[model samples]
Target: MSRQFRLPLHSPPSFAREHFAASPTNAQAIAAIDAWPRWGDGRLALIGAAGAGKTHLARDWALKANAVVVEAANPLAAPLDLAALRGRAVLVDDADRRAQGGHLDDETLFHLINMAGVDGGTLLLTGRLAPVAWDCAVPDLRSRLNALTAAIIDEPDDIVLEAVLRRAFAARAMTPAHDVYPYLLRRIPRSSLEAIAAVDLLDEAASAQGRAITRLLAGEVLAFEGDEGED
Candidate 1:
């Protein structure tokens, strides 16, 4: 038996506004974001589960606000500076990861919160959960988190999830049989991220076997996924 060698394909996701698919699940969040400086405190917390399109929404806001984007998973590696951000927008993505207390630097986040609230900048903090649910040991930071106005994006519903799958497949120029879509929707989790991952796995499997993606291939990949999870 020979092992197949699949090259590492780089498919960078597009976070452009046109690429974002809106639905009832995220309508309010998008509306809130569009409302912008209309927010009382010029600060907001965008909350959603993994693969819930939080980054897409955040990037959309950034485009409109001309905001600088940073991951809470990796805050400023250099010295923090907020002098020039006066009355501007800043997006701190994955802001709830407490690995380093501030997405990687708690003290810096604490300061950013104060600056945005009391000073001039507009800050949008994104996380997997609401502020109340985030794990932060900083006493001062907790209070700031509580003060933020939050916009929550629920995980994708059936319609949105289907659109995500279709879009993901289209992006790769791959089309499964018409019935494959319903077959997949029934078996996979309802999430934008999950749809993308499922497509990737199926793509890899099809490429390895030199076959087009069909219902049978999807079932095989899904079965493998379940087996891996059980292990």
Candidate 2:
């Protein structure tokens, strides 16, 4: 087989509502967001593991509420105007990572929570764990997290995972064998993150080896990754 150089291509993930694979798994979170201004305490955390569609849902809420979206890491480098955020919708993505990431300090985080909690603003935070479980240097911040309401997004079901896999491949403009989904679904861990990883590994293998992705290629890749038989 003739080899072909595969240049790295980047396809940014879309956060639009239409791009989201909505299902009962995330319906609770979606409903919590839609409940909006009436949210108990005016603050809520969408908690889930990676690729569980937290960011996508956050984006959808941001659009509907005209919420300001900011990475948890950006605050310390460029602090936001607390007064301006009052009575508005704000989303701080990856907020739980900030405590250990050294991107957001306890004081800043404390104020963010305080502002929304007491000042009539609506705040949304996304993370894999609940805010109360996060490691916080400030005792005050830790206390506030306990009062913060939270919504959980369960693991993606078969339908959602299938949609995720299909969309990921389509986004990369790669066409695998028609049997790819069924063959791999029962074999790999049932999670969107895992599905995307499978597609990524296969895509890389196909490009590097200059061959189309088939069950054989996929199996080789999965075996190499040791991600098989985890259904």
Best by TM-score: 1
TM-score of each: 0.85, 0.83
Question: Where does candidate 1 clash, by residue pair?
Answer: 102-106
Model 1 lDDT at residue 185: 74
Span of ten consecutive residues with least summed lDDT in model 1: 1-10
The local distance difference test score of each candidate is: 0.76, 0.79
Instruction: Give a tens-digit lDDT track for model 1, residues 142-207.
Output: 887887889999978877788888988887888888988877777677667777778888887888
Reference-based lDDT, residue 169, model 2: 90
Candidate 2, run of 10 with poorest lDDT = 1-10
